[model samples]
Target: MRNPAFGHRADRTLPRYFYVLRNRDGEARLPVYWEPRPASRDPLVREVYRVRVAGRTLEAGNLHVLGDRLRDALGSLLATGQPPRFWLVNGACASPVYREGEAYVALTDGPRLWGKDLAELVGRYAHYLASCNGGRRAPVSVALFSPADLDVHWPELVWTGPGVWIPVFGVDGRLTAFGPRDRTWSVPAGPGAVLELWERVGNDLVACGLLQHPAALWGSEVSDSTRGALLASSEPTGLTLRFVHFHPSGAGRVTLPIRRLEGRVFASCGELSCLHVAPDPGTLREYLSAHLAQAGVVAGLQDVVLEEDGGASLHRLVRAERLPVGLASSHA
Candidate 1:
């Protein structure tokens, strides 16, 4: 009888691979090896990469993609130290066999190819890959999804409603947008953990009343004493939205109803008091910087007056500069 684990093959010489599966005991380190075919039958496909593990062989078009897949499989084995029922890989669904191959690579324990799940995975991958390609900046494009879609698809992230795009920041102080949305977003390599942090910050802003629904029309303005009380409390119930202006010099000044903002009054004075609050900038800035360097948000807080109902109303501000091109107009 032929060995079920080994495929009938003619291998000239191929490289083998191994990695230490770290454990408390440090007794076992499984060696993994695969032979790359010289070339693929299909002209477009450069080559075929195969990886055999746990009695299953998997193949992918590119070496890096296969490497990532193997890394994920090894990670799972290390966590439980037991052979999983099926190997898990992104962009795939549960099926008897993965892709069109004789290799019995069963992928029966991965996320279903639901529209929502696929979009999220695509967005994450796109973000990750784009960020990895050096420091070149690119325009951001975000698909608008309804509130219902957000609730169903991304319960962890918050959406304040249509036309209100969440801002994602980068190390260069540039802004981008990513949130719960319909359709797939083709993001590169690994937005991964950073994107998730951005979403959590957005949700916190909404919860703290810094991000309000545009349709609310009436701003959730609060008194100075009330704002102070809210900030002091462990669970702040402040619905008081605030605004800021960003100067060319990268300094942020906030509009405050009170004469002195955080005890520092600015020399330049107007109806819209753009005061540079020292030491402490207030709740919005505090929330934005909650994750420190990982958050990627800038630390400037200038206030602005919003015209509403033929009167000036103070509302929380998110810069249109940060939103994806052509999306800012929707808020108008």
Candidate 2:
């Protein structure tokens, strides 16, 4: 059976594939995979990666020390039983499968004494070694590969949101609205590139454990915090509701006080906010829904709350009698 790691993308164009699984000894064993991209050419330059050795200790607590162990694992043990002066491994034993913003490769069991697996291990470890400075993330260059022949397609890595986007193929592939502003930095626009780029990014994200989808809005922590408060204030506030649209940027919030005036919902959003008048709560829900979606997407919002504000990560507020009528999304 295809590795579940690949999920729906088991048919990607890689020439060879292996999973990063642990053996009975619990040591990290790797499959020797090598097919160098056009980036690294010199054998000495490749020493930064140990394209030869395969035995690695996965439980190294320190990421820096882990880099050292990786170098040793990929380096060659000479016939005289000595670590080499120049290097020994020189293939794609360690290349990354980029997922979300991070990279990961398949693990294997048994012998770590293969030359081919060196490529996969060396390339992946090099990336992990370059980073470890807490939250400061270093960027990486993306070179696209086709099948096993190793043709190079250089694309600008779109380091946005929680992950990276490489438009190896132009258009939306699986990702929508990823039109690179500067075309020169990305591959030429193509009919197939859009979907291809998005599909690859999406698939690899799941495989490498980098992509994250938040809980449904009501199921969110912010919602939980505000839920009880929302119900508690209902009888006290009458029908007037005060809501704060928490900006996603942590920049600030937009507070909107909504009330019914002559059977029409009238609400204002600060100085820049809009005046939304709807016939009923259902119609008002439609207006609020559109604006909320935009707020969540554009402003990078934290939450839509009932009025009271303050939290380590969230807050509370909102008024209805104390709700805005159709409170469909806030509870069970």
Candidate 3:
């Protein structure tokens, strides 16, 4: 059977071939390899290239690792020669086979490349290939997708929104806009409705976690303090929604009112003060870092919390709400 990791041959043509090379110390290393593109009517070349160890040849042991090495080597060679526009990997393992009179090889077990995790890996490989193909000036246009079309493109979630034009940061940490500027961030008309957008910084998608409905607007009888207490409490009665939008600097902008209540004893009856605080910058920064890490973009939170004191004095008390549970469940 042809190696699913590499490819097989048909009609005696080796369409594609890959080989692995190990150093004398038995450490796997990535290097360059070259071979003549096979003619259309030749059996596939099983041994594309050999690794030399002090004038001796090395043997292939682990086929999977070998395939990875071969891929890396081929990538390096392609960089020096006519680089490919883009490259992708399915992340599977299989043996190699040759065909009669075929110069090209085809990969088997292509189904292994199917799922969300595998698709992401394939995307990463494509990104690596693009980098090797050329400099940033000649960017390789590539798209990543899972086996099913229903799977949302990861970046798309962070870059685009419903009706609002928000800014989004690119993979390179530059900010860009999503949609046209004339669009308004509209909130649904209901007891508790809100609209949300997100900004992307690095690989992260940042947006407001939740926006209460019109009935839960800031101030009024349902004061921010009361809402905060309710949310923090074990039993949160208010309806909450999350909104996310991308920023131009690859960072996301999240806006939500922080509500908490404090009480003071008066000569007649105790008075209640409502306090509304903004999202914590530190928490936002941490969230962004975590999100980007999955995309192979590692970033530290430079600033997470941005505090704007509404000039209200209030005491801090944790409320018993299901919000924490909701967050945990969503992450899970």
Candidate 4:
């Protein structure tokens, strides 16, 4: 269960580079490739020494080499530093640049044995490669998950990086981090609030979940009462809500216009929504009148509002456009 010790090599026979060294009786070295770097400058290298203590390999010494000629320089540094027990050198750094092929291999082999989650393990390795190569951005592959098994497995797979946690949602519409807490966070799932359009409910705040179509709704089942209350508060006037579907290539289109009581306009598409409230009657009237003028000509006035909740109730619109007839659709 112990993590492998990773570092760079210090020996002059190997090119100056980063490596992952192992410890047997002494320091064992494994040279790490310096991904891709600027062609004009030599790749910077680091020497890592590891020792096997108990059952885990522990890092012993790490040294950095600036230039090929700096072999003597690095040697001097290591002489004063801790000596490694064993080492191995890699002539060509394993391409830190991960691709579909590499990701498949890592997912099948690397992560299963390393005790590291695939995404985090790949991300960290990618980062290390990028850093050694002077901040070159590495391509990332999307992690795959099955919808049926998401609920059970997602919690165990949560991975935190520099700032945010990846795959924020667990299955069953619950926040992964709020273990045993049913009512994780409360927000008004009513008017003035942006409800994810794809799902009738409000959830869809997390990045990965937002990417899903028919975005998941937020709020617990109890919020059904709250939704009823907001509807009741709105004016009795009925407005038309139009749902427009567009093609990616801007060719095919379909429009659905429905009537609903209006207070403030709210529209949702996938995991995103927009709410628009006019500041004053004048502003509201001006917007509607303009739309009324262009009513049928060019997909005008997608939604119509009849009553205002004492606040400016402008039109709210959602764009659930589709791909063009010939264009390929995105894999959700």
Instruction: Residues 1-332, candidate 3: write the lDDT tens digits.
Output: 23244333333233233333333334323222324445525454433443322112333333455555545644543343422211232223221211113121222233222212222333334444445457332222222221111111212212212212222212222222222312223222221211122212111222242222211111212234223334443221122112232222332233233332222110000111221222333343344333333323333233223345343122323221233322322110
lDDT of 1: 0.31
Off by over 4 Å in 4: 1-108, 111-250, 254-266, 270-332
Error of 3 at 6 (Å): 53
- TM-score of each candidate? 0.20, 0.20, 0.19, 0.21
lDDT to native, each model: 0.31, 0.31, 0.27, 0.30
Q: Cα deviation of 184 in candidate 2 (Å)?
A: 25
For candidate 2, the 10 contiguous residues with the lowest summed lDDT are 213-222
lDDT by residue (108-130, candidate 1, tens digit) is 23332222222243344344434
Candidate 2's residue-wise lDDT over 184-296, tens digit each? 22233333232233334444454555443111100111112122332233222122223333322322334444443333333333233233334444444444444556545
Number of backbone-clashing residue pairs for each candidate, in the order shown: 20, 45, 65, 26
Cα lDDT of model 2 overall? 0.31
Candidate 1 Cα outliers beyond 4 Å, as residue runs: 1-140, 144-250, 256-332
Error of 3 at 53 (Å): 54
lDDT of 4 by residue, 1-332 (tens): 11234234433343333333333334333333232223534333233433322112334223332223234423532452432211111123321112232232232213321212344444565565567569985654322222222111222122222222332233343323221111123223334232222122222334344322211122221123323444444542333333223343543222212213343332211122112223233344344333333433124333333342333232322224555555632221
**Model 1, residue 171: C-alpha shift (Å):** 34
Please estimate how well model 4 matches the true structure, expressed as its whole-model Cα lDDT.
0.30
Where in model 3 is the C-alpha error above 4 Å? 1-118, 124-128, 135-282, 288-305, 309-332
